[model samples]
Target: MKTADPALQAMLRERNLRIIMPIASILAALGLWEFLVWYNDVPHYLIPAPSLIAKTLIQDWATLAQSAWFTVKLTLLSLSLAIAGGVLLGMLFALSRTVEISLFPFAVILQVTPVVAIAPLILIYVESTFWALLICAWIVAFFPILSNTAIGLRSADHNLRDMFRLYQATPWQRLRYLLIPSALPYFMAALKIAGGLALIGAVVAEFVAGTAGQNTGLASRILESSFRNEIPRMFAALFLVSVLGIIIFLTTSWLSRAVLGHWHESEIKREL
Candidate 1:
């Protein structure tokens, strides 16, 4: 029988290691935490063991699920709005340097300004809790996407642009063929960043809104649990938030790779 390629074996080993290492590390940390808590006879209220957290998560699944769905909806809505606004404005900025010069500073200001500070004012102006939360999340997520997409649109090959100009190409044609293509990688990169920020923004907005009522998001649930001295339930809600964050990251990363895998150096797999 032919011998297996050593390079292939090495690649397979590396892939397994990537999966195994994180799982191992997470288990090790949990074990150490559980052991410390057990040895010290720490009160569950202080920091419930992971086992208790798991049980609480299962027990409170119905309530937590509703909140999780609400949070997910807010995150997705905010991210969608951010993408639409970012791409449109980014395209416009690419078309007109003067517009970019005039408006980019405002975008920078929005980025520098804390959404937490802005959220309270937004709540006063926007009567609807949903819309206020959404706007807060959008503010947090919009800038990275706009900046990256604008940079990408401007970064198209100068030679190709000159050729397009020589060909008397219509502006739309140039944008479709050259600018959008050049911007995809950068947009994808920004998407991954924005996804996490969007989740954070949604949570923070929920926090600002506080535990107003039964039908609310995870942050509200966290507040509700804390006030009632349901520490385990609070930890459970917190775990869900962390899990959602990981999901957003993994989902966005997969999307980026899927979009760029064929040609982009960042996503394309190379031989060991």
Candidate 2:
């Protein structure tokens, strides 16, 4: 059999590094953490070993599962609202320069404002806990989608727009045929970012609202764990949060690849 080309070999090596290195690093860190806890005889309340954290997660699965489900609900709903609002607003702005100029500054202000500072005020006035959390998460997630989609709409091919004008294409025709495809990559990019931000916003809102019992999210569980000095359980809640973030990232990344891999160079196979 013919040998693989040197370039293919290099690509394989790079791909292996990409996959293997991170796993190796995580395992090494976990091993070190476990060893340190064991060697130093550190109490579980101080710094629980990775194994202890895992045990806590397994033992508290019922409570943690409920908390995780609540958090997931918040994240997904906020992201969905952000997507709908952002895309519609972006398209409207793309069509009307005057409207964009007038309304865009307000969007910028919302984006720049810290959600933490605003969350307490929102909770105070919102009247409903769920809506308050949703609003806070929506606020965090909305702007990236809006800005990226707006920029992407504007980034559509000028020459194509002129040709469409010459042919007297309708607004819908222009959007469907020319602009939407151009804006897709930007929209997907924003979606990936918004996913993480939505999770963070939901958790932060939960922390600020500080409600407990059946209606609570993972942040509440974390707070409860901290107050009770259940350090391993706190770590377990944190672990779930990190895992959720990873899942969001992976899901968005896969969505991006699925949509754009065939045509977009960013998603296409690289030579180097």
Query: For each candidate, how many residue pairs have backbone atoms clashing (under 3 Å)?
Result: 0, 0
Q: Put down candidate 1 lDDT per residue, 1-272, tens digits, no spaces.
A: 99999888988999999999999999999999999989999899998999999999999999999999999999999999999999999989988999999999999999999999999999999988999999999999999999999999999999999999999999999989988989999999999999999999999988998987667999998999899999999999999999999999999999999899999999999864
Q: How many angstroms is residue 247 displaced in model 1 relative to the true structure, after the best TM-score fit?
A: 0.8
lDDT of 2 by residue, 1-272 (tens): 99999988988999999999999999999999999999999999999999999999999999999999999999999999999999999988988999899999999888899999999999889898989999999999999999999999989888998999999999889989989999999999999999999999999999998854467889999999998999999999999999999999999999999999999988999654
Model 1 residue 253 lDDT score: 95
Q: Which candidate is the best by TM-score?
A: 1
Query: Candidate 2 at residue 87, lDDT?
Result: 91
TM-score per candidate, chains pooled? 0.95, 0.93
Instruction: Please report how far candidate 2 places residue 47 from its true position, in Å.
Output: 0.5
Indicate which candidate wins on lDDT. Answer: 1
